[model samples]
Target: MTGGRGRFITFEGGDGAGKTTQSRLLADHFAAQGRTVVHTREPGGTDFGVEVREIVLHSRSHIDPRAEALLYAADRAHHVATVVRPALERGDVVLQDRYFDSSVAYQGAGRVLDAGQIRDLSIWAVDGLLPDLTILLDLDPSAARARLDVARTRYDRLEAEAAEFHERVRAAFLDLAAAEPERFLVVDAALPVEEIARIVRERVDASA
Candidate 1:
């Protein structure tokens, strides 16, 4: 899909899996190599997406699973069109915090929706734009929750979900990595930050 352009790499996992930190480190690595790096996230990669993110992540009221999925797809559509695609075409390494995988794992598995349908909707939303590599930071639910508790005072909608929901999401992410071994680098998120960063760099270097 990239046609020899800059690579798109996404970080996926359950909440508090250290995706944000890992993505930043990877972005910095690429920048040190004199590469243009576009570090962004799913629901807030653009202005339109930021508004959608506020609604989906911070809304105090209930949102149906289907509606939540659609909102994510809408944000993805706009984010890809406005930010991701342009950066890739400019030969910039795109390091994204989340992507369609999160939608499939969270809304599909966590919410008990249809995973296949969620994937299809996302594919249609972004015109089949898939990342060249996806780094899956796998961590136990309890460990991840503890990390969240230490890191923040307020929790988002997804962060506040019960333990079982997070377990389902983690399983879904592992299943996805298993299904697409070439595209996914599954790492233990409990590892030290530098170790995880080293592992990610090795995989990325091999791919490059």
Candidate 2:
């Protein structure tokens, strides 16, 4: 997929699945190789996205499911337009923490909305800018929550959801990976951090 162009890679999983850790490690790997790496995350990659991230992830007031989905799509649209696209055009490797897959899993499945519709809206929002590779850190919902509990004293609105909701989100993530086997590298998130990073680097090396 490179062919003189930049590669876009994304990470997806339930909360506390170690996405931030893994993404930072991968970014370091690219930096060591002297590659121009854009390490960013959706819903907060751009200035506008920061506000959307606050509303969608932290707001105390209840937001409609459809509205939540739209907020994510809006963030994705602007982030891709201003940040992702330009970086790719400049031949920089883009490593994103989450993408539309999160929206499909969280809003579509967790909120009981239409997954396909959410995906379609995301595609339109980003003008079909799919990742060249997506790393999915698969982990059980309960285990993920346990990790989160130890890592943080506060939880976002999504993180504070019921265990059942997290379970649904995890299942949705696995389903998305299954449907796109070629684009996804599914790894057990229960493994040691170094082991997981090694596995991810292997796949990324092959893809690159």
Candidate 3:
């Protein structure tokens, strides 16, 4: 897929950090510029992935930590193979919501698992396909929660975690961005939506 001259852009952030909104805006911006864009998300990008996503995110019982990690890896493996890679191979800009970084943060930091191992699992699952650019939208967990739709009856498994868990997830995201500064663009998620979109577009234009 890397040989196809296409770009893979991923959004990484804590819950309600506006990844979905920003990813859509970026894809739309590229599309308006006449670029072929494929917008997708982890754990639900393919038919197989959707089933896995439902089990992992909405199951009523407590999932074992390792089992949860493996489930995520399985979804990522299938999603990359069936959706992400093929889209990239076709020379289209692939904008993804929540790639490996989410696993590293949610399962590793939030779930108290080894971060290195979680990263390794994700890398192996995706066959070492890293995003060309990862936009990390940094936000305070409290503020993020406020952005959630309160009218909804239940939160997803990860989103229902305590404030401390979200704090750790946020920290892990920043740590990952720090480790790979060249490949990450850390943005303040509290910015106005249009401003955030403009900054993301500028970065994508400069890099992609």
Candidate 4:
């Protein structure tokens, strides 16, 4: 169990925040340090997850919030049991692009579900699995959106959401980091990608 799966590091942020780029850098760094690093993403990390992702992210019309939450939770449960846990047990450093944090921000904050309720449901869904670290690449909503052009999926439905809603999600994410200072990494992602990557490199190396 200890030979391959090392630790699980998750990268989380709003769209256009450059988490995927930074996560890969960190994964490569870990690999250079002689660890087995697996770079993956949520909602589509497995075959079933891939199928579910389309239903969740690509629905043509508005889907009920409660139903969307259930879909995300279900995808997460499958991802953990099939993809995440096995990688961890193999001692691979799992670098995930998005995870539970998305549910908390999107469904809890954006969807108007009571934060406490979402937290409880998420806890039950994942059965206590938590990231070793969550790097939140903080950026202004408008700036991020401009960089992103337009959202392409039903998940992007949230993309067209009111700025106030995204603001709430941002505040909630910040609050989450505040609540758990040790595990939440707040970075100013408004900087140029390379500069942001540099800061990420410094921070991740320190953490590693």
Candidate 5:
């Protein structure tokens, strides 16, 4: 896949697992090397996506599980069409903080819905676009909570879920990575930030 014009890299993990930090590190590294890199995140990558993200993540009222899943799909469809695909076509590396995997884990596993069906919905929404490399920062929900700057009571909708829900989400992420070892680089989220970034960079460099 690296032989292609542009590379697509995705970061996946539970909340407070340092996905944002590592993704930023990667984008900066590539940009420093004179590569054109587009650093973006799901659910809020575009204007419309931001509205959807707010509804899904910060809404005060209740939302049905299926409604939540569809909202995520809607955001992804627009984000990929307007932001991701265009960057890829221009041969720019796209460092994304999350993608379809989040929907599968959060709405499917965490929400106790059909994982396969949720995955299908996301695949169709994104038109089957897959990342060349997915870096899964695996972390225990307990430790992840400790790493968060915000109080637990102040967590977003998804982040405020029960521990058991987060466990299901973590398991789903591991299962997805296990099913696609060639496309996933699983790392311990407890590792030092610089060390984690180094490993990610090595994988990207080798693939490049």
Candidate 6:
């Protein structure tokens, strides 16, 4: 299967996993290889997504867990329509910093949302689309929180959530990898950022 019009690769894991940095390096690599590259993130790719990002991340007002998951799905659906799909149609490599799996870990595991609900929304929002490869940057909770750039986002709110929740999120990510081994690759993100980038490049090369 050619899948979509192009290749979709997502970077996933808990916060401070160096996803943004790794995505950038991989984009540069693909650009060097002459693959039209599209680098994007969730909850803020488009205008509406930016609004939703604020409401979901920084708002003092409480959002129900299911509602939060739905908002994320809504953001991703809009992002896919406006950003990801079009780029793929143009034969671009769509590299996402965080995609649907973030929802599965953060909302489904961290927020205690029902796993079935998350899975359903994922299926609906993604519309049968799945990443050709997902690079999971695995890190310990304390280590990740220790290196966090500082408390700004909601998941960062979980940094103070103690080590256990972050551990659960980590476990959830590993579980996701186990459930979809062919589509998922785990990397030890606790190492240097350069090493993580190298691992991502290797995975992409192997897949390509």
Q: Report lDDT (CA) for all predictions.
A: 0.94, 0.94, 0.91, 0.81, 0.92, 0.84
lDDT against true structure, model 2 = 0.94
Off by over 4 Å in 1: 1-4
Q: Backbone collision count in every prediction?
A: 0, 0, 0, 7, 0, 0
lDDT of 2 by residue, 54-105 (tens): 9999999999999999999999999999999999999999999999999999
Q: By lDDT, rank the candidates, best first.
A: 2, 1, 5, 3, 6, 4
lDDT for 82 in candidate 4 is 83
Name model 2 segments beyond 4 Å from true: 2-4
RMSD to true structure for each model, in Å: 0.9, 1.2, 1.3, 2.6, 1.5, 2.1
lDDT of 6 by residue, 1-208 (tens): 3346789998998887788888999999999998889898987989999998888877777788888889999998889888988888888998898888888888899888876678778768868678889999998877787677464444534445667778888999999999999999999998887888888888889888
Per-candidate TM-scores read 0.98, 0.98, 0.96, 0.90, 0.96, 0.92
Candidate 4 off by > 4 Å: 1-5, 150-155
lDDT for residue 195 in candidate 3, whole number 0-100? 98
Which model is ahead, 5 or 6, in terms of lDDT? 5
Candidate 3, superposed: residue stretches over 4 Å from native: 1-3, 149-151
Residue pairs that clash (backbone atoms under 3 angstroms), model 3: none
State the lDDT at 140 in candidate 5.
95
Candidate 6 total steric clashes:
0
Error of 2 at 157 (Å): 0.5
Residues 1-208, model 5: lDDT tens digits: 5414788999999999999999999999999999999999998999998899899989999999999999999999999989998888889999999999988999999999999999999999989899999999999998998877564557799988889999999999999999999999999999999999999999999988
Mark the regions of model 5 whose C-alpha exceeds 4 Å error after superposition: 2-4, 149-153
lDDT score at residue 183, model 3, on the 0-100 scale: 90
